[model samples]
Each structure stands twice: as structure tokens, then as C-alpha cells.
Target: MAASLTAFAAAASADTLFGAMEKAYVTNPTLNAARAGQRATDELVPQALSGWRPTVGVGGEVEALISTQRAVVPEADELVDAVINDEAVSGNLAIELTQPLFNGFRTVEGTKAAEARVDAGRQSLLETEQQVLFNVVQAYMDVYAFRQIVVLRKQDVAALEEQVRASNERFAVGEITRTDVAQSEARLAESKSALVDSQTNLARAVAKYIQTVGNEPGKLVYPKVVNLPKSMQMALDAAGEINPRLLAQAFVEVAANSDIGVARSGLLPSAGLLAGGQVSDPDFTEDQNENASAVFGASFSIPLYEAGLVYSQVREAKQRASQSRIQVIEIARDVRRAVVESWNAYVGLGEIIKNTRTQVSAAQLALTGVQQEYAAGTRTTLDVLDAQRELVFSQVLQVTAEKNRVVAGYQLLAAIGHLTAPRVGLKVPEYNPEENYQRVRNKWIGTSVETVE
Candidate 1:
């Protein structure tokens, strides 16, 4: 059992963390959904710019008129009456164009707002990507640790079984009492139960692994701790400066303030150029009776009053902008708190891992000594069973401590805003949100540049 445990430990040295991370980076549904969302947000820029373009339209009108007229002819001492009936058909076709010269800077401010929103969306996607990577780290560690515990439990069950057989043999030869044989049997049963529990835990971890990494976990290898900030203060500083959530909120605030500008622009005058031409045919004659007119003019409009609608909208936008600014402050506080907590857990887990390793070694030595003393008739069977149980508990603790240590490191990485595919050097094609933004920012005409899948 011990030899097989050593073999499993040796095989765990394979480096599979990057493979798991790459799988998640490329195929995770949540991350892909965020990418699609950002791509949708990218169209806001072009939609805003549409306000500056020309609008062309064609129109036609047709009508038929019927009339009756009565005429009286004057004669010498006589009166004459005449009735006349006539019908006329008229048709006209007109083409018109209008181009915006100015809209009180509304379009300018609106475009700025859209650009800010796109920036915010990019940051929001980054935040989601970071979260996915962190979840992958946790799931990977869980599977690895649980599998290790399963191995430990199996070995413990086997060892206890052998002890039980030995105790039974000694009782049959009159070398040990029936109570000794029963003690060994009870310990063996308990070990078997623990082994079952470990197996269940391992199965749960595997399920989580599938959910996170988008596939079943294969032979997993241990993950090495990535480099961290030199000090806790440095970590906090980095998080405050570059954390995705905080950056996203800052961009949202900018967008909200831009919206306030857009609302205020409603109070100013708008200017445009209009050009049109119309051709008319009356009396149903194609060339004999026809008229054509052309018109070109510059137009200006100002809202004298709107029953307080525009004013109320301006006030509402101002309040929303204020709220967004306040949210940035709140998010900054939360980020700092997260950084501090992650740092403490990271440090504390390191200490716990060291102590648990020592505990495992001591328990192993104590268990071996107790078994030897029991064979020498100096220690009772119950003493040996107790030592074995202690050893098993220490082994479980050691695995759990290692799991927490690795997870704490990942948590700190996420808190510091460096948990990204490119930052982590995951060997997969990285999705650049800026590429989509640049592709469609100034597009004049199209359904979409490309679909993000």
C-alpha cells in the first residue's frame, strides 16, 4: 500500500495546470457569453454616429378631380344658361434629402457616451474572464486534493485490514484476547467508512471540475504557485489601480456624465440642410401641361418649451451620473477589502500547510511505534487502533491544507486583477475585446463586421 501511494505521488508531478486553464479559456460558456455581450456593445458607437449622416427619401402623389360649371350668355333682351362638366388628373413625384449640420452637440456627446460604454463593456468582460479562471483554479485544486485523499484512505483501509487479520490470528493462538481482535475489527470498519466518504468527496470534485473546465478531469498534476506582489500594500495598490470591476465602474461613471451632457444639449438649437425637387403633370397630359420646381434651404429649430420634459430628463441624468460616481467609490472600498482578506488567507494558509505536513510526519512515526509496542506486549490493541486513526486524520488534514494553500494563492491573484489568460500564459488564443471595438467603431454601413460566437 505504501509503495503504491509513493507511485501515485510521483505520477502527480506532471504539469497539467496549463492544459486545464487553456481548456477553460477557450471553451468556457460564461466567458464566451461575455465576449458576445461585448461585441454587441461595440455597435453603440456606430449607432450614435448615424445621427450625423444624410437621410434620403422618395415620395409620390396622385389625384383625380371632377367639376361641373354653369355659364349664362347675355343676348339682346334675352338670357341663356349653359352647364359644363370637366375632369382633370394630376400626378407628382418628389425626391428629398436632409443632412444634419448641427444638433446642438447632442450627437458629439452621444458618441462620447457610447465610446465610454464600450470601454466599460471591455472591462466588464475582463472581470468575467478573471472570475472564470479563478473558478478553474479552484476546481482543479479540489479534484487533485480529493483524489489524493482517496488514495490515502484506501491505503489506510488496507493497513487496518491487515492488522485485523493479524489480531484474529493471535487470538486463535491464545497470544491475544478476544477484545484485541474486536478492537482491530472496529478500526477496520471505521477506516472502510472513511474510505467511502473520501470516494464521495472525490466524485463531487470531479463534477465541479467538469462544470468549470468544460470537460471531465483527466490525470491531474499539481499546480505551482504563481509569483505575487512583494508586499500586501503593493497588492492593495495594484488592485485599486487596475482591478477590472473598479475600472468598469469608472468607465460607467464617465458614460453617465456624458449622458448628462447629451441631455443638456436638448436646450440648444439644431441646424440642418434640406434639398428637394418635384415634377408635376396636370390634366393628364404628359408634355403639354407640366410643371417642375426645385428647392434648397438651410433649416434651424429651437425648442421654445416642452412642458418641462427636457428639463426633467436633464435633472434625472444628473442624479444618475452622481449615483454612478458614488458607486465607483463604493467599489474601490470593496476591492481594497478583498485584497486585504485574500492576502491574509494566503499567508495563513502557508503557515497551516507547513504545520499540517509536520503533523502528518509525526503521526506516521507515532503509529509505527505504537504498532511495534503492541507486538512487544507493551501497548494494548486499542492504543494501536487509536494511533492509526490519528494518522488517517492527519493525512486528511494535510491534503486539505494543501488544497486551501493553492486556492488562497489563486484568490489573491484574482483580487490583484492579474488572473487573465495572457497574464497567466495560458497556451490558447486570447480573445481581444479591443479588436472587435476597433473593427466596428467607425463603420458606416453593414449589418455587423463579424459575429462573435
Candidate 2:
């Protein structure tokens, strides 16, 4: 897995977003934490199943003591007898086994609850994965967008420099005033400053991308094309039945409902089986004696009263379960709203892109005409400078529109909980939580061990 992770990271450094996301899924600390949490929850399964299995234990103890004793005869023949006793020791070894025959269905309820908890943990992991994927997409888009801006800014600077040179030539030939040359110089300086700012933004964006994807973004690749579903309703429908937040809430409610069963089980009778053996040695006799006994018997415990504690617990669990259900409804509503908003924003940006493309084309043509007219002495220096600025503005707008469209696409995916690895064209790592649980659970089930270890 580590080798695979390294390979994926290498690919991401070449600006493969999908590969980067896969690497993050396999090695990112935040996602690993969620996987660990899921594994932790799996332990609950054994705890619940323990009630159905036999528990065995062995213990031994040894003790030694010394004492002095004195005896006195009658007064007529007064005599005293004293003796010191030492070398005293005693020890015993015993083994005990206990098996639950019944516990008011507590074992059954406990196992069910544990299963529900496992489901909840799984959903939580999925949610974490979705979040990580969303971050990767956003960061990737940011780097791409910033790179585009840098290119555009560089071009703007070059255009301004050319205008400045042309203005200087016109002034030397007595074709334009000093004021015209000064204005051209000022525009060139402004373009240089703007270029610096664009470069700075690009640097910051690269840093963010590295942080998000856990590797340097070497040559970022832009997606060749992104297809947006025609409508928000269509997108929501495509999301289908597996929204992470909703799935998590559903499992949480199941867990809470299971808690009610566990509480109710506490109010009923419980039964178990018991068996044991023991051996002992006493210092009074110089010989050690061994004794062993084994007896299988059933035991029962009936609950009479618990100061209404069980009832209270049941009521609390029920309320929590009801709250979880409400949360599911709230999440669904929020998801719908988000989908609609992102869809609208995406559509709006698409229109802007179309318009900006036309604007850029028109500005390019205008700049060409202004430069020719200026050389012909039919247009002023200010006219040429203005045309160049308009062209730069249109180019900037076009770049921004492209970036917004990418971001909106990812946001829509996130809102629908479809931003996870598989949905986003990345590979998800397979992590089986039950693998460890089965190791211990299978050995302990329907059998007795001398020691737990």
C-alpha cells in the first residue's frame, strides 16, 4: 500500500488531480484518523458478543507467618512454657468459568447496538473521504486558475511595453507630445505592478495546492472538459440514495434505537452457567495435597427495582433517536438548497464565459485598429493605451469565469455528497475493519480459553 501511495503521489506531482486524491485517500492523516475511528468502533462487537461466550480465569496466593506462644501452670507448681513457631506457608490455585445462559435479551440487544455503531462509523469514514476529495478539487482548480492569470498578466505587460516603445519613437520623430509618451510609460509601470501581484497570488495558490494534495504540484493539468447536468433537479436525482450526511444520521438513529433495547433489557431476568476447580497446600502437614472439582450449573438473576433508572435511560435514548431522525430531515433540506444554489451559480458563470470570450475577441480587434491608426497619425496615444487596457480586462474576466465554472462544478458535487473517491474518478483504498474483530471473535466464540491472551 505504501508503494502504491508513493507512486500515486509521484503522479500527482505531475498535476494529476485524480491520482493526487487517491494518494490522499491512502495516506492523508485526516482520512487515516477516520479509518482508525472506524476500527475502534469494531471492538464493540466483541464486547457485545462476550455475553454469549464462556469466561475463564485462574488465580493463586501464598502466605507465611511466625508467632510465639507461652503456657503457665497452676500457682502451686508454677511453671512457664514458651515455644517459637516459624516456617508457615499456605497456598491455593483455583480456576473459574462462567457462561451466560440468559440476560433478559441484553446480549442480543447489545450485539444489535454494536452492529448499528459499526454502520455509523462506516458512514463517518465515507463523509471524511468526501470532504477530503472536495478539498483536493478546490485546491487543484485554484492552482490552474492562478496559473492562467499569470500567463494573461505577462501578456498584458508585454503589450504595455510595446506601446511604450512605440510612443517613444513617435516623440523622437516629433509625431507625438511628451505627455503622450509619459502616459504610455505610466501604463507600462501599472502593468508591471499588476504582473507582480498575479505572480504573488500564483505562489500562494501553489502552496495551498501542496498542502491540500500532500505533494508539490509540478505541472498542473487542467481538465480538458467538464460537463454539467442540465438542471439542479437532475443533479439531485443523480445523487440517488447515498448522501453521506443522511446515511450517517440514519445509522445514528439506528444506534440510538438500539440503546433503548439495551436499557429495556436491564429490567428483565438474567441467567448464566458456572463451573470451577481448586487445589490447596497447608504448612501444618509436610505434604502437598491436590483437589479438583468441576460442576456445571445454571444461575438466574431477576431484577426487582432500580429506582426507575432503566426507564429513564430508555426515555433518553428514545429522545435522542427522535433527534437523529430530525437531523436527517434537516440535512436533506440543506442539501437540496445547496444543490440549487450551486447549479444556478454554475449556469451563470457559463454565460459569463461565453460573453467574456466575445469581449476578448472584440478587444483584440479594437487594439489592432487603434495601433494602426496611431501610426497613421489618425488616433491619439491615449486611444491605443485605452484599447490595450480594455483587452487586458476582458482577458482577466475570461480567466476568472473559467475558474468559477470549475469551482462551481466541484461545489455541486460536494453538496450532493458525491465528491468521494469513486464518484470523482479516484480509487478508494479498501480497509476492512472486521478483519481484526473476526480474529478475536472467532476464537472466543463457543469455546473456553485458559487465558485471554
Best by TM-score: 1
User: Which ten-residue region of model 1 has the weakest summed lDDT?
Assistant: 444-453
198-229: candidate 1 lDDT, tens digit per residue: 89988998898899887888877777878688
User: Which residue segments of model 2 deviate by more than 4 Å?
Assistant: 1-14, 70-83, 165-186, 224-231, 288-296, 376-382, 424-453
Which portions of model 1 show Cα errors greater than 4 Å?
1-15, 61-91, 170-187, 280-290
Cα-based lDDT at residue 36, candidate 1: 92
Give the lowest summed-lDDT range of ten residues in model 2.
444-453
The per-candidate count of clashes, in order, stands at 0, 0
Judged by lDDT against the true structure, how good is candidate 2? 0.79
- Residue 327 in model 2: shift from native, Å? 0.3
